[model samples]
Target chain A: MTGQVRTVDGRVAGRRGQATRQKLLDCLSEMLSSSPYRDVKVIDVARKAGTSPATFYQYFPDVEGAVLDIAEEMAKEGAGLTDLVAGRSWVGKAGWATSEELVDGFLDFWRRHDAILRVVDLGAAEGDKRFYKIRMRILNSVTNSLTDSVKELQAKGKVDKDISPAAMAGSLVAMLAAVASHQKGFTTWGVKQSELRPNLAQLVHLGITGKKPTK
Target chain B: MTGQVRTVDGRVAGRRGQATRQKLLDCLSEMLSSSPYRDVKVIDVARKAGTSPATFYQYFPDVEGAVLDIAEEMAKEGAGLTDLVAGRSWVGKAGWATSEELVDGFLDFWRRHDAILRVVDLGAAEGDKRFYKIRMRILNSVTNSLTDSVKELQAKGKVDKDISPAAMAGSLVAMLAAVASHQKGFTTWGVKQSELRPNLAQLVHLGITGKKPTK
Candidate 1:
């Protein structure tokens, strides 16, 4: 069972306190989307949330801390991404379907939480361990499953034995994450969304199964 | 012919002016690597360069403008990356070597300019047209070339014609950028650089040729 939420001052967040905290987080998220992360401030978040800076501090230590909270929530939701790959087939037309669905699902998830994810990415890139762990938590949800799928196929002589499954899966997942983050860049390059999806799925299929999809 | 460098006020930069301008850019680049992009200030860059903020203003309008200047310089260098694939054979062992070298070269370029590229990535993700254009200038140097390689292979009946060459090349380049940006993340995931590089090269090879490398 999950423990009850608590304020920064170590007091349990009652119904109203929790409501206020959620409001602050919502406002912070919106602020992040509209402005750069470094410019987000306690006063602005509080103002947008219809609260005061004192109330903001009562719930979270700082903007980074609040952003971490949002990232953690998103990571929990990101765990659901495992279903997109777990126990999925990597053979014939079924494999193509799995790859297509995985790209579709992953891109959709990333686009939805892009603002918070961007901050998290910057934090991790800056060598912040807290943000790094959250990023791994989210990506690993799908990566670990995909790694296993590759390993399983390799064991069954369907994939190359020399290939490192973890690295392959990690690279593929990184591609998905990178492509998802820069979706607009692709569009501007004249690659349509519909075209990008299948090409990515093709690469995924080729990487995992070492063959073109039957479909 | 290259034009003379000029100050923000439209005065041509003399030797000393250009020196001062270069120093400021170097200082700003250092500041970006050491701190969050949003927190990087003109005053800080000016102080770091041992110049007054007024002198800093003589050459560049703001941090973003200065960043674009650095990005433009990098993009020009990035155009040289075309040599990694232009007119190169993508068949048999040569294809594998090409993939390996491309991965190595692309990763090195990204790692060297990561601090600035991170800002570019953030800017592009935030829908900033200036940053997006700079990013395109850099990636297109490689993506456009790789797209041609894929199309060439498809024309030879080596790759599926149904696959979009641009999308495939774009995804592969995006993967390289993503993996390079998060090289530290991969290490933390227990994937060694030794294992990471070959796997990426393998994926690139597979994606481009629709077959495993001959190596």
Candidate 2:
């Protein structure tokens, strides 16, 4: 098990303290969804949490620190996305199903976590190592698994020798993520959700197997 | 031709005024490159431009307005991205060349304007229609041309019938944009620039043509 949660002042947080800390984090998260990340103030989060600013500082050093806490939890959950591709077959009908399901699961995960994910994206683009680490943790989980799949296919001579599995996997995963983040943009372009998933699935399958899906 | 450039207070900017305005925008752009968006204040931008905050205000209403001005100018140039895919043949060696050049050009464009593009992306993801429109202007230039290519290929029985041209084109373009924005991320993943370009070209060719490149 992980060690006990601690306050910023170096004191270990008990059950009650941990509960209060969680409450603050949740409030900060809600604020992030509604306001710009730069505008999210610690006192406002504390006020929304029905606690004093001092109580908040006891848990998090600042608004950014609290966001990192929430992102950490999300990354832990994101690591589970490895299931979408790991051990999945990439041939014929099975390949199509795997691709479709990976698209569905990846997009759903992005939608559920878009708010904090946006902040993490911005922070990463701004060259913050902490945010870059978090973004990498999430993308790396899926990309690494997909890379292994490609390498396996290559070893069996089922895939081209010239393809860099890491680049292919990373690009495909990045596409899924970029598409997921901008799903709304597609809708505005008159492309519905139903049309999107299949096309995305097709690209994913083609990128992996280098052949059209049997479906 | 576009209308004469005007300051926020209803005065058409003269030559010297236009020069000053451009200097402030250039300084603001530099500031965005080095500082977080939220932390960027008007005073800071003015100081960097060697002007007072009042002079900054005379030309633009606020920092966001200035950013919008910069984005607007960039969008006009970005519209030319259409040339990358418009009327490009996706057959045989020509298709591979088209894909490689598009990837190269797209990545280079993204790198040159990354700082402003990051803010535009964040604003669009935050649901700002102004930023959304600018982004759409750029992506649609490519996506529309690509969608037409897919549809033409499908009509000639060169591509599959099940493909949604718009969705396919949009997803592929989104992948390009995402990969372009995060090019540095790929390097950190141990994928070299040389490795990335060919792989991205392969995926683009595969997605558009529904077959592996002959290369």
Candidate 3:
């Protein structure tokens, strides 16, 4: 069973408290979208949420704590990304479809949660273990599934044996993430969103199968 | 010809003024490394630099302005990355070496400037055009050359005709940048630095040539 949501003072949250906490998080999310992460303050979040800073503090310790709570929620949602690759064939026409769908799904996920993900990425880059683990938690779902697919293909002699499945999968996922974070960057380079998906899927297919997709 | 450095007030910097400016930038860089970009303040940077906030204001309007100054300097240095790919052969054994060296050099540059690059990336992700342009300035050295290489390969029927040269090159550059930023993530996944280089090189080779390296 899921544990009850608790306050910073160790009080179990009832429905009203939960609503207040969620409102703070939602307001914080908006602030993150409209300004730099560093500029987000508990006072601003409280004001935006129509609450008090003491109420914000009661729910979480600081800006980072609240950010972590949001990232945790997003990570749970990210776990569903595994279905984009789980039990999917990586052979021929079917393989190309898998790659395309994976690219589509992954990019959409990143776009939806990019503001929080950016902060998570910065925290991780700054050597914050909690943020690092949360980022890993999100990416691991798809990464683990992709790794399994690569290992399976390697066993079938379809992929180069020397290719480290983990490294390959990690790199591809990183590519999807990097590209997703900078999706607008591609536009500056004259590559459209529609044009980018198939190319990424192509690279994904090539990385996994070591052969061009049949499609 | 290069223009002389100037203060925020548009006064051309003399030797002493330029020295003070450089000192401020150095302190700002150190602060960036030790703290999150969001928490860095101009007053703190001025204090760290052994200067007054007024002096800091003389050279730069704020922390973001100083950060942009540093990013510009780094991007100029990053233009040297073009040598890693310009006129490089993408055939047979030499091609493999090119891939390995590119990965090596790119990773080193990114690791060296990871802190500032993180801010640049965050800015770009937040849709700031100035930061995005700077990020592109750094990446385009390698990307432009890589695009030309891909285009050449396609013309000769070595790479896939359908592949968008810009997209492929952009994706590859993004992969290198992403992987470099998250090198620690790889170690946590049990992939060593030594193991990662070859796999990335292999990917770079496969992506560029559309075939395994002869090596």
Candidate 4:
């Protein structure tokens, strides 16, 4: 036991720990991309990670916990854009930008984190109670950023004041989900990325401005 | 073989066919209410329907096909409402007698079809291509109905002409989906049904009228 511990100590411990975590996440991501979250087990993830089940448990309590970690990490990466938006005036800096930027950014996020998004969607829909709570936390963070933008627009009289920011926030989040859902169906419908961004921008613009741009 | 065929024909061909279909759908409804769609298998559905796996194929080709049939049937039943709306102006008989009536009808739809809605949400997230098509069809139908209403309202000078009817229509559909998704998370968030209708109505009014309600 001491020898085994010594072998995993010092620089090797730190290096191996980081490598193991990345390997696990990568394996989980690959599996979740092709399979349903509920169908993927810890043992499967462990095997895919090139580690034993005991080694897998050393990091996550269970498969869901690992997924939650993946979700949190993805959320953190996506959170950067939200923070950037937060630092600016919604009406002047964010709202005035072309709808393409918004749509493109959103699509990019989905594309970059498609695997984690798949797991998050699955966890939210079918995972246990804890996973759902984590899902809400992610949603709330995203919604808060949107609500802030809406609030800024309302303050500048650019948006309708009569509407509730919370509801609008909900609508925005749902629209994003709808877009993601559409993207998931893109291959089947023979829709290409070239067509997706424009259509999505139109949809988002319509939702936000309540007016369709004459293209 | 002829006797078996005759028995199947006599008992499972006409009214029996309908009964078997209903039984299968009912079993699916029950199973889906408690579990996610992906988790529900054809065998489980057949067993719950009190039939063998072979018999399950008689009515539907697969689980997705069966659920799609059920959704189509529900959509058909709801089709009458759309047709009635199509034949009249927003203030006419088919358009909602009162605000409460409108809210009640919407809530009733959710409550009645909670199981199907769950299936839709589950299937929508899955990489299943058919699920998105089904969702798009529902959205298109609702959008058409809403567009008619928007056109009437615009003609009456009640709705802003600048806002495109199609955009508003998409928002309305997205709103309904948001409300349903919110309700799905109700247990974890402790959301009440009483709060649902008013919020939904307010959002609808905002999207359609482009103005805040007096309430």
DockQ score of each predicted structure, in the order shown: 0.77, 0.79, 0.76, 0.21
Q: Give the poorly placed runs of model 2, Cα more than 4 Å off.
A: none
Regions of model 4 farther than 4 Å from truth: A1-21, A34-66, A90-94, A98-104, A146-164, A183-215, B1-21, B41-62, B81-107, B125-127, B148-168, B186-199, B205-215
User: Ten consecutive residues with minimal summed lDDT in candidate 4 chain A?
Assistant: A1-10
- Compute the interface RMSD for each candidate structure: 1.1, 1.0, 1.0, 4.8
List residue ranges in candidate 3 displaced over 4 A: none
Please state the CAPRI-style docking class of candidate 2.
medium
Question: Which pairs clash in the backbone of model 3?
Answer: none
Report the Cα RMSD per candidate.
1.7, 1.4, 1.4, 6.8
Q: Per-residue CA lDDT of candidate 2, range B67-156, in tens?
A: 999999999999999999998889889999999999998999899999899999988888889999999998889899999999999999
- Between the candidate structures 3 and 4, which one is better when assessed by lDDT? 3
Docking level of model 3: medium
Candidate scoring better on TM-score of 1 and 4? 1
TM-score of 2: 0.97
lDDT of 1 by residue, B100-156 (tens): 999999999999998999988888888889999999888899999999999988889
Better of 1 and 4 by lDDT: 1
Tens digits of per-residue lDDT for model 3, A44-162 = 99999999999999999999999999999999999999999999998878999999999999999999998999999999998889999999998899999999999998888888788
**Alpha-carbon DockQ of candidate 4:** 0.21
Candidate 3 iRMSD in angstroms: 1.0
Q: Assess each prediction's global lDDT (C-alpha) against the native.
A: 0.92, 0.92, 0.92, 0.62
The digit string of per-residue lDDT tens for model 4 on B100-166 reads: 3444565567667777765665566666556656665655565677777777889889875655676
